[model samples]
Target: MAHLAACAPLGACTTKQNASLRSQSARVVPRAHHADGETQAASPALTRRGALAAGIAAASLVLDAQESGAVGFKKELKDKRRGRTRIPEEEYTKELQDGVKYVDLEEGTGEVVKKGTKVTAHYDAFFRGIDASSSRQARFLNENINLPEPYDFAAGSEIRISKSKELPLPPQALTIGVIGMKPGGKRMLLVPADPWGYGDKGYAEVPPGATIEVLIELLSIGEA
Candidate 1:
């Protein structure tokens, strides 16, 4: 896989808001597999937001995770092209339960990530659209423009929301999204705009109620 890099503090992209709106909640509903081995499920209620108080609490949790060695990253890439493991095309596209959909691009070889596990990875996020041009060439919200180096953070840590016009969603979404992944594994997450992403009032670049497609590559996982 190719790598891109840009120099900017992660905090610069997030924002804090004072409100009591409920944060989106999703449960890992398991579904039975068909002969094709695909997982399927009905959609759940979706809303995205983090109360200012919750944001502060989540930040505290991140610091504790870091101190416990639950979050960290590598400065270099061992193998950029071929990750540690790979998943089959059909298997990667299997149907998912709940509203969130995921396709495992690479099946990693490291330990499965748990709640407190520290993780290192590179992510490319874009707004999904139906129009050909919008869908095919959507701009990336966050990506490594030049280097392969990955960012380190706790799997369940809550970072501040992006400062861009986009409203902040719950930080746990990333944690829940990457739970079963191992180091070197890559997955594409189709996050519903409602509860999992920006709600009615979309960000400056993304429209209201637009689904967000996030390509996450797990570089490494550390001990808790």
Candidate 2:
């Protein structure tokens, strides 16, 4: 196994290691799609809030998967030269629209992530540089760099809001980006630096007007 680590502000540091992929044992909930592009889970037995809480509880299962040595809950892609897992990349340049862009690296076989679905995923967020030739290799902002510890959160849930107009809103782009993903799926999201990402003021590491690219891998989806 190989471990990758990085230091960032807010005490956000992650260590990722390569491991085999395996399925987690959990109940599956039926998923439904809405006209607005949001997917919803069918859970009449539980209230909306209850369903949300149940979704969050599913995150614990990710720990079990990790303990089993399945870092991203998926197969490892090895880079022979560096002796590390290789990240799948887009073949061509993708233009960003609607303040975001995403590409699926691996399609998951599990249930689709809908509203109120608790999702566990691993992500690496990078700062898109002003120079096109150097953007892909630019510096990262926060969260996991290449380490694959799963981040657990509910889709469409409001987390924190930035009170300052200069700062970007929290959880907006990320929540919307992960919707419809299935367990084991890997996706790359490009978020514009406006209301969707670190805004004019940015953060301690992120600069103003810098775009962010996030690579996300869905580890598990909790039963509704």
Candidate 3:
């Protein structure tokens, strides 16, 4: 009689356990109904795919907007360049090769820039233009004077502010422009709208066909 009483409670417990498992499974597994009234468990794989597709679409839209904005900005720059006139060559003190011109503001007395020397300097750039009367003015574009560190590059290589470090060390215009410059010297260069000055492709905020007026202050010279 004792064993029978124990067996009866065990059977009741098993029944209760089965009932609880069924209730939990029903709550956890969602069902989907088809048009023909066939019911099936909802697919977690399908839910994940839907979410992935939505994320990709949102990302594509953001990319498209960014591309559109860049294109619009480039067009605006081109239009602005078309309306501007070049500054007269006589305004500069001396002319270097390839039509690059410079006027010495303050001559440096420290070290001369030579081949393979790394030059460090702070610079301010402007877009130069003239009016119908041939009077020229510089419109400020960018500057690195307030920055804690100055630009350091090879003396005879190309340097574009908008480009990465992969570009050649400095532009020929700059190389020739800084030929006699020493530490603490300042010079203003009028770079022509050629390959030396971003060329027809232009640089960030510098319009196409724009002549760049750069005021460079020589800070230091070191071996590369």
Candidate 4:
């Protein structure tokens, strides 16, 4: 600490409101001056006072004014994405007819389950027979359970209750029961009040004697 000060004059370095910012790389974006002195682009150095806001606005403008066709890229991609997991409307109609109930897995794609690979995902779950519409009363997480029993697969990989409840096997997870699913597939599971950890007593969030439903997606499995 003394070495740096000794190397320079006492007033050479001083603290200022923007002293911290001054030491760091400049985030300002310069504006381009056209023939009329109007801006075609923002100059980071000249953006002094409103640098942050100006940079953000400039970035937004740049992104907004991207190649005309680029704006439609998202819509186009969505159109194509509809084809990836796209269940035909006819299939949906068929499901509506059969009365078979299933929550169309959201963000259910992009899973390549082999023997062992790590994964992660979030799910919204609820018990069945609770009006069949909307009644999400409980949520649980970090229910890490290693599959194929007893074998350590990977660290930091997580499997939620909904996903774990489906499988028939286990090595003792926070909760028992998750749909045994393939790598990329997502599942919704319902844990009966009895089978769930709570033997007799129940709590506020979770009913004392009520079944619980969970939704989960296998994010990844470690390489074996």
Best by TM-score: 3
Off by over 4 Å in 4: 1-119, 123-179
Predicted structure with the largest lDDT when compared to the true one: 3
TM-scores, one per candidate? 0.44, 0.44, 0.47, 0.28
Q: Is candidate 2 or candidate 3 better by TM-score?
A: 3
Instruction: List where candidate 2 sits over 4 angstroms from the true fold.
Output: 1-97, 129-149, 160-171
Question: Could you give candidate 1's per-residue lDDT for residues 92-142 as a string of tens digits?
Answer: 464343576788778989699887788876665555322111111223455
Worst 10 residues of 3 by lDDT: 130-139
Worst 10 residues of 2 by lDDT: 17-26
Ranking by TM-score: 3, 2, 1, 4
**lDDT comparison, 1 vs 2, better candidate:** 2
Ranking by lDDT: 3, 2, 1, 4
What stretches of model 1 exceed 4 Å from their correct place?
1-98, 129-149, 161-172
Instruction: Put down candidate 3 lDDT per residue, 41-154, tens digits, no spaces.
Output: 789998889899999999999999999998897787555434344445677968866778888888878768886778877655556541111001122224311113456667
Could you give candidate 2's per-residue lDDT for residues 187-223 as a string of tens digits? 7777777766667776545677777666666778896
